[model samples]
Target: MSISLEQVHPLIGNKFQIETSNGIMHLELVEAEERPRRGVPESFRTPLLLIFAGSSRQPLAQDNYFIEHPSLGKQVWTIAPTLADHAKGQYQRPHEDGSTCLYYQVFFN
Candidate 1:
């Protein structure tokens, strides 16, 4: 079955696990954004951008990772650390609870 925004949208704020050499790292789904482009056919799915917040302040190196969710199962994708749209003034900012967290981003197109 194909994964769609509909299936992932509600998953925001939920935990997703990523397998790393350090073991299984947990991430929380933070944002899901649809980016519509001109000239793209409606038959093609709009590109979706997803961002996840990790509890660790340390950033992970970019690579293909096996990320899993209970309902979404396991899938491999290129994951990279991002500054979370730093222009928004959230770069390296502590979370609501004042805990520092790093952000990662993945794209689906």
Candidate 2:
């Protein structure tokens, strides 16, 4: 299912347990901070990006996560059960009527 950025931002740095159709997905918002880079031209400026994700079990595993920024974009990442398993989905976008919608599903089992 899809969730809004506003709805999820407050939960950063906290543990989250969500009930999915297949099973429970345990997520922990590890760290959220502004990523800084040096070497870029002074004319370039990056929007504030926030990162959030779930803890993993594999050795040296990378956390399942998402990155969001007002101007850049939003992205979600999760581990695949196998190379053959790939799912597609979409995210929420606000409408002219001020209504929000979310339509996405990512497999993490």
Candidate 3:
């Protein structure tokens, strides 16, 4: 099965384990969004883009990681560390700055 965001939408708000060089880490699917290009013609379906957010306690290096989900199995994603959203408040863990989670975004078409 392809590892596109469309295949993973059902697992939103769920946590999945990712195999990393450091070991296994977990990422929680926080949100998903699809935005059409402002100038794209209605006939162009491929122009629609999908984006989703995954939160994890352990920050990841800029690279692709194969994440495993109980139901969805494993899929590769290019994970890039993003600033923690202050709006979410403190997460389950405590970080040096007292904020517990960092975020990553996955993009697909």
Best by TM-score: 1
Per-model clash counts, in order, read 0, 0, 0
Q: Which candidate gets the maximum lDDT versus the true structure?
A: 1
Error of 2 at 34 (Å): 1.1
TM-score to native of every candidate shown: 0.82, 0.28, 0.65
* Best-to-worst lDDT order: 1, 3, 2
Error of 3 at 19 (Å): 0.7
**TM-score (C-alpha) between model 1 and the true structure:** 0.82
List RMSD in Å for every model shown. 2.5, 15.8, 4.5
Candidate 2 local lDDT, 17-87, one digit each (tens) = 44434455544443233335456556645323433233232111333545343332455555222111123
Model 3 residue runs over 4 Å out of place are: 3-7, 38-57, 85-99
lDDT of each residue in 40-81, candidate 1, tens digit only: 888887888888988654458999999999989999978888
TM-score of 2: 0.28
Compose the digit string of candidate 3's lDDT tens values, residues 25-62. 77777666565657766665433222223434456777
lDDT winner, 1 or 2: 1
Error of 3 at 38 (Å): 4.2
Stretch of 10 with least lDDT, candidate 1: 88-97
Q: Is candidate 1 or candidate 2 better by TM-score?
A: 1
